[model samples]
Target chain A: MKLYNYFRSSASFRVRIALELKGLRYEYAPVHLARGDHKLPDYAAVSATALVPTLELDGGERLGQSMAIIEYLDETHPEPPLLPSDALGRARVRALAQLVSCDIHPLNNLRVLKYLVRELKVEEEAKNTWYRHWVREGLQAYERELAQLPPSTYSYGPTPSLADCCLVPQVFNGQRFNVDFSGLPRTMAAFDACMKLPAFQQAQPSNCPDNEA
Target chain B: MKLYNYFRSSASFRVRIALELKGLRYEYAPVHLARGDHKLPDYAAVSATALVPTLELDGGERLGQSMAIIEYLDETHPEPPLLPSDALGRARVRALAQLVSCDIHPLNNLRVLKYLVRELKVEEEAKNTWYRHWVREGLQAYERELAQLPPSTYSYGPTPSLADCCLVPQVFNGQRFNVDFSGLPRTMAAFDACMKLPAFQQAQPSNCPDNEA
Candidate 1:
């Protein structure tokens, strides 16, 4: 198996976390997103969306979308499941993950931020504010959901689940934009708990082979 | 089951399609997004994100996020499954769905469009251009993926799957914004096939009770 990804992409970091959690080994194939490698025809052929974190299976089949890829990994591996066995619990965890993926991360991703400056002509500070605003609003929602659930070691249970895989990456990206983490207790607690694990540490940007800073 | 949703919301429309396809009976509970019904305290109590398209079960448990809600419905009611039986096939369908949900729809959703006008002060034409741009790019990608797969009546197979559940609503929303559909053959074909179905026709915004126009 080979993973085509960028070190700093949160979506890529998500698939990395899932792989590491499952103790799966795959060759790292870096596609530099900042350098516009994703737009190149070579990488475009490898991905339909021309996005990072495309997992090519050992049989040569490729899969994209971090959430979908993570779910596939969980389904195939099945040891230390990223989602709960029950239907309702799985829905709750998936909802938490989508709260980050759909609501927050999409607004602040590199392409969207680039558009804000280059296309919309938004100022630097205002762009950063836009990034922080969505993160804060999303984390507050996450905290609210967590308040409704029984306290667990991770996002939804004693072990790391799909929600934690998403939340940790978002928090990591948020910190880079100076997103305020003051009001989000349960959200931050989940992040702190995730960071204590070796899988999360290994999958972070700084530890990636293509890390620039 | 009861669905708290707005007629024109595409995410809400996705859940409606899934429920209709599964032949599940759900009471329509409208939360008008444009009128700010989702921001009210009552809606907030029903959903942590205060977003519409929340499915409240007979047991009083509520599920947010349309994708998660659809998946939950499929899991609990297994007949006429929205996903494929194989893991790889399921992954492909989900990737196609997220290509719209996470990429195109998020960029053009009501709140993001509102933020463009209110916060960024982007002009109306530019905002519409922004909406059309993301939708076109995403649908092109959807076309590319479909071209890779075998021809089918819907997005994935002879029957409507999760990909059609997502694609139909996106195409509907994109048409309202005057998104260019000339170059996307496979994508449009799938949308056309979906529109031919009774379930898709019944779940459309115009068919909903809360539809104003």
Candidate 2:
């Protein structure tokens, strides 16, 4: 398996975490989002959508979407299942993941931020305000949900699961963008627990091949 | 089963389509978004994040997030599966679904639009421009991925799957928002095909419990 990755893309960060959690050995083919390699014809051929973190299976099937790719990995390699065994639990975990992945991350994502700054003529401070707004709203709700979880060391359970996989990255992105974590103790606590794990540490943006810093 | 829904919520629309596809009977429990019913304590008890399309199963399980509910429906129902038979195909279908669900719809969702209008002080026209811009970028890429398939009537094969479930609601939102579609022939063509189906037609917002002329 090979993953087309970009160091700072939160979506790519998600797939990397999933791969690390599953103990999957795959070559990392850095797509260099900063250099616009993802927009090039060569990379575009493999991933028609021009998105990074496209996972190419050994059988030459390419899968897009970080959630879908992570799901495929979980299904194919089920040792430490990323999803809960029960259907309802699975749904809960997915909802938690989507809270970060769907509602929060995309709002503050690099491309969307670029569009806000470049296209909409949003001032830098206003763009930062936009980013922080999503993080503040989303993290407040997330803190509430995490607080409801039976006092787990992690987001869902004691062990890292798909929810943690998503939470850690969003927290990383939130912190990276200077989103205030003052009111989100549960979220910050869970994120601290997740960061202690080898898998989480292994999947950081700095750990990726394309990362310069 | 009962569904906490809003007619114009694309997330809610996806679940309705999934329920109809599964031939599952569900009581319509509309949460009026314009009236701010979703923010009430009762509805928030059903959904922590205060989003629509929370599926309360017959077994007393409450599932939030439309994709999570759709997957749960597929897992429990099993007949005429929403996902493809193979993992790769399932990944493909899910990636396409998330391309809309995760990437597109969330950016242009009612809540986000409300945020733009209320908090950001974006004018109505600029809000529409914001909505249309994300739709065009997402659908353009959606059209690119769809072109890889055998030119089927739906987003995937002839039958409506998860991709179609997400696509129709998005198209509904797009058209309702007046997002221009002259650039996306394949998408419009596929959406047209899906809309002809009774299941899709039945799931339309105009057919929902809270829909008003």
Candidate 3:
């Protein structure tokens, strides 16, 4: 298996944490988003959208989208499941994951930021404001949901499930953009707990082979 | 089961289509998004984020996120599955769905549009441009992926899968924004095919109880 990834991509980070948590071994194929490596023909042939975090299986099947790839891994691996056994629990975990992946991250992603700065010519400060705004709104919802559950090591349960896979990355990006975290005690607590685990720590952007700084 | 949904919401439309496809009976509890009904205390108690399309199960278990709700419905229902039988096929379908749900719809949704016009003071025409840009980019990816599959009745196969559930709503929104659909032959074809079905047609915004205009 090989994963075409980028160090700074929150979506790539989500898949990397999932791979590490499941103890899956795969070649690291970095697609440098900053350098436009993903837009090159070699990467474009493998990923239709020229996006990072395309997991190519041993059988030559490729999977795009972080959540989809993570779900595929959980289904095939089975042990240390990323989702809960019960349907309702699974729904909650998935909802939390989508809250970050869909509602927050996509709006502030690299492409969207580029469009804002280049096409719309949005000011730098306003761009950062855009990033922070979405992050705060997303984490606020996540924090509320986490507060509903009893305090645990991870988002939905004691074990780090799919929500943690998503949460840790969003928090990483949030801190980069200097989003306010003071009100999100539970979310920050969950992030801190997940970061303590080797899987998440090893999957950080700074730890990746293509880390710039 | 009861669904708290807003007629014009693409996310709510996705779940409604899924429910119809499964032949399940669900009471439609419309939350008028444009009127700010979702922010009211009653709806907020059900959906912490005050987002449309919150599904309350027979036992009163609440589920949020349209994709998660649809997946939960698939898991418990399981007759005509939303995902393919093969894991790889399932992954493909999910990636296609996320390309729209995460990449396109969230970026141009009512809240984000409101932010652009109200908070950022972006003009209406510029806001529509932003909407069209994201929709075009997202659908370009979708069309590329769909082109890879053998000619079929739906996005993935003869049967309408989860990707179609996501696609039809996106195309509906794209048309509303007057996005250029000329380059997307496959995607438009899939949309046309999907619209032929009663499930897609009946779940449309015009058919909904809360549809204002």
Candidate 4:
């Protein structure tokens, strides 16, 4: 298997965490988003969306979308499940994951930020403010949901489920912009717990071969 | 079951299609997003995120996030499965679904559009352009993926999978903003096929109780 991804992409970070959690081995194939490598024809051939974190199976089947890729990995390698066994529990975990993947990360990803600046002519501070606003809002929602659920070590349970896979990366990216983390206890606690795991540590942006600074 | 949603919300429409497809009866509890009903305490008690399309089960377990809610419904009631039986097939269907759910719809949702005008001070025309741009880009990506796969009656196969549930609503929402649908033959073909179904017809925004001109 081979994974084509950017080191700093939260979506990419998500798949990487899942891979490491499953102890799956894959060749690292980096597509640097900032360098416009993802826009090249070569990368487009690998991904229809020309996005990062596309997992190519050994059989030559390629999968796109970080959430889909993570779920695929979890299904194919199910010793340590990324989702709860029960349907309702699965729904709760997935909802928490989407709180980050669908709501927060999409608004602040590299492409949308570029559009805000290049197309909308948004100033730098406003763009950062936009990023922080969505992150804060999303994490607060996440925290609220967690408060309703029974307490657990990770986002869903004693194990790191899909929700933690998503929350950790969003928190990591939000830290870059100094997004306020004071009020979001459960969300941050999940992030903190995830970082303590070897799998998450191995999958973090700083540990990637293409990491900057 | 009860669905707390607003008519014309694409995410709400996605879940509605799933319920209709599965022949599950659910109460239509409308939450007027435009009138700020979602922000009220009553709605917030039902959904931590205060987002529309929350599914309240018979046991009073409310599920948030359209994708999560649809998957939960598919799991609990699997007459017409929303996902493919195989893992790889499921991944492909999910990727197609996420193309709209995560990439396009999130960027152009009501709150994001409101943020553009209220926070960024983007003009109405510019906001509309932003809406159209993401829709076109996302659908083009969806078309490309579909082109690579074996031609099917729906987004994945003979049945309307999760992909079609997502695509039809996105195309419907795009049309409101006059998004260009030309050159997306496969994407439009799938949407056309989906519309022919009675399930899709019954779930459309115009058929909803709260739908307005």
Candidate 5:
């Protein structure tokens, strides 16, 4: 398998974590988003959306969308299941995952931030304000849900699930933007718990081969 | 079950089509997003995010996120499955669904638009341009993927899979923004095929009891 990844991309970070969690060995094909590599013909052919974290199977089939790829990983390699057994539990985990992936991360992704600066001519300070506003709102909601759920080492259970995979990357991105995590004790606690695991630790952008800084 | 829906919300429309497809009867509780009804104290209690399309089940457990709710429906019902039976096929369907749900819709949704106008003070023309820019880029990618798949009556196969459930509403939104559809014949064809069905037709915003226009 070859994962077309960008170390700093939250979406790519998600697939990398999922692959690590599943203990799958894959070639890392870095498509540097900051350099517009994703828009080049080759990467564009691999991903219709020209997005990062496109997982190419050994048989040469390509997959996009990090959550979908994560679900595929969970399904094909069922041993450390990323989701729960029951339907309601699966829904809970997926909902939590989407809360970060869809609501928060998408709003503050690099492309959207670039759009703010390039297209909207939004100043640096206001753009940071925009990023933090969505992060705060989203993490507050995440914290509320985490507060309601039963206490565990992770966002859901003792073992890390899909929610934790999504949450950890968002927290990484949030910290990069200097979004305060002080208000979200539960979310911060879950992040703390996940970071203790080798999978999450190794999946950090700083640990990736393509890490810029 | 009760669905807290807004007729014009593409996310809510996805759940409505899924519920209709599964032959599940659900009470429609309209959350008028335009009027800030979602921020009310009662709705805040029902959904921590205060987002529409929250499903309150018979057991009084509330589910948020349209994709999560749709997955729950598919799991519990199982008749006329919304996903493919195989893992890879399910992944393909989900990727298509998220291409719209996660990538396209969230960027142009009501709240984002509100932020552009109210906070950023972006003019209406620029805002509409922003909307159509994302729509065109997203739908073009959707078209490329649809063209690769074997010709069928729907996005996947003969059945209305989750991809179709998501595509119809996004097409409706694209049209609302006057996005050019001629370049995306595959997407338009899939939209046409789905709209021919009573489930999709009846789920149109115009057919909803709370539809404003």
Candidate 6:
């Protein structure tokens, strides 16, 4: 499998973590979004939506959307389950994942912030304000949910599931923007614990081939 | 089961389609998002995130997030399966669903749009531009995928599964905004066919209890 990824993309970061967690070997094909490489014709053919983190397979299968790609990998290799076994438990994990993936992260993606500055003519400080507002609101809800778990170490259970995959990347992005995770003690705690694992630590944006910094 | 819903919310509409498709019996508990009803104490207790369409099971199990709730319903009641039996097929269907759920719809949701116009001081034309920009991009991908299918009346196959559940709401919202559907004839055809089904027809926002206008 070949994953067309961008280093700073939280969506791609989440996929890398999932792949690492599942112990799958894949080639990384970095598409630098910051450099407009993702918009090139060659990369555009692999992904119709023109988004980074497109997973192309050995058998000519191409997949997009980080959550969908993660689920695909989970289905193909079930060793480290992306989801829980039980129905309700699976729902909880998925809801937690979506809370960040769908609700929070999408609002603060690089493209969105760029749109605020370019299209909407918003100032730089206002753009960061917008990012922090959604991040804070989202982390507040996440902290509320995470603090209620029996153990505050992980998002849901002992093993890192979908929630942790989303949390680690989101926290990384949060820190990049200086969103101040100081208030989200439970969320920061879980994120810290998840990053200690090899899979999570190795999937950091800095570890990617296209890391600008 | 009791579904905490708002009639016009696309997320809640998706759950209604799933429940109606599965022939599940449940009481409707409406949460009016426009009137600050969802911010009330009782609703806050059920969903810490204060989002609509939280499914409360008969056994007192509470669930949040639309896709997760739909997955739970599918798992518990397997007669009309929402996901494909095969993993790749499931991934494709989910990708199609997420194209709208994650990418297009969230940006145009009432709260997000409200934030743009209110907090960011983006003009109405810019907000509408933002909405159509995403909807057009998403529908282009959706149309391509729909065309990839073997000329079926539906998005994937004959039966309306996960993809159709997502397609109908987005198309409805898209049409409401006067977005052009001519380019997406494949998706338009599938949307037309899905609306004929009782499950899809009944799940229309106008069919709900508190459906205004």
DockQ score of each predicted structure, in the order shown: 0.90, 0.78, 0.84, 0.92, 0.87, 0.80
Selected candidate, larger TM-score, 2 vs 5: 5
Cα lDDT, model 5, residue B158: 79
Predicted structure with the largest DockQ when compared to the true one? 4
Q: What is the lDDT, from 0 to 100, of the residue B107 in candidate 3? A: 90
Better of 4 and 5 by lDDT: 4
**Across residues A69-169, which tens digit of lDDT does each residue of candidate 2 receive?**
98989888997898889887788789888888888988887778887777667788888888888888998988877766778787787677888888887
Quote model 5's iRMS.
0.7
lDDT by residue (B84-183, candidate 3, tens digit) is: 9998889989999999999899998999999888877888889899999989998999988888778887898888999999999998889898999988
| Candidate 3 vs. true structure, TM-score | 0.98
TM-score of chain A, predicted model 6, versus the true chain A, to 2 decimals: 0.96
lDDT of 3 by residue, A37-88 (tens): 9899998899998787899999998899999999999999987899999988
lDDT of each: 0.94, 0.86, 0.91, 0.93, 0.90, 0.86
Highest lDDT model number: 1
Docking class of 3: high
Q: Can you list the residue pairs that collide in candidate 4?
A: none
What is residue B76's positional error in candidate 3, in angstroms?
Answer: 0.7
Better DockQ candidate (2, 6): 6
* Tens digits of lDDT, candidate 1, A1-213: 899999999999999999999999999999999999999999988998899889999999999999999999999999889999999999999999999999999998999999999999999999998999999999999999999999988899899999999999999999998888997887888899999999999999999999999
lDDT per residue for candidate 1 within B67-89, as digits (tens), equals 99999999999889999999999
Q: Candidate 5, residues B1-213: lDDT per residue as tens digits?
A: 999999999999999999989889999999999999999998888998888789999999999999999999999999989999998889889999999988888899999999999999999999999999888888898988887788878888879999998999998998899987778887888888898899998889999999989
The candidate 1 chain B region of ten consecutive residues with least summed lDDT is B184-193
User: Which residue ranges in model 2 land beyond 4 Å of their true spot?
Assistant: none
Candidate 5: RMSD to truth: 0.9
TM-score of each: 0.99, 0.96, 0.98, 0.99, 0.98, 0.97
